[model samples]
Target: MLIIALSTNIAMLCLVSAVLQIVLPNDAPQWLIFGNIVVFVACVYYTYKAVTVWPDEEKAATIS
Candidate 1:
């Protein structure tokens, strides 16, 4: 659940960054775009991990 929460939070942050990048003027700092890209990648990774991995309880159930 914590991983799910983190993934959702990261995804939401990425969406915010994307909206800012689109609505903000081009004169916005280049670093902001780079930061957004980094954040987007992080969100993607977190989402993938959250979906593919299991919690302790889940793993124990699977083993039995």
Candidate 2:
């Protein structure tokens, strides 16, 4: 649940950052754009991992 919430927030941030980059291509700082991209990628990877692992976690809980 926490991870889902975090992913949602990060997704929004990425969307906003992308829009800003498009709207202000010349004004947006390179580092900020790079940082946003890194964070977005990380968020996507972790979210996918979490989702894949969730079924295992549920099975473990049910067995216990």
How does each model score on lDDT? 0.78, 0.80
Q: Name the candidate that leads on TM-score.
A: 2
Model 1, range 1-64, lDDT digits (tens) per residue? 7777887787778778877877877677777777777787887887788777755887799989
Task: Please give the lDDT score for candidate 1.
Answer: 0.78
Model 2: which ten-residue window has the lowest total lDDT?
A: 18-27
**Top candidate (lDDT):** 2
Residue 48 displacement in candidate 1 (angstroms): 0.7
Which pairs of residues collide in model 2?
Answer: none
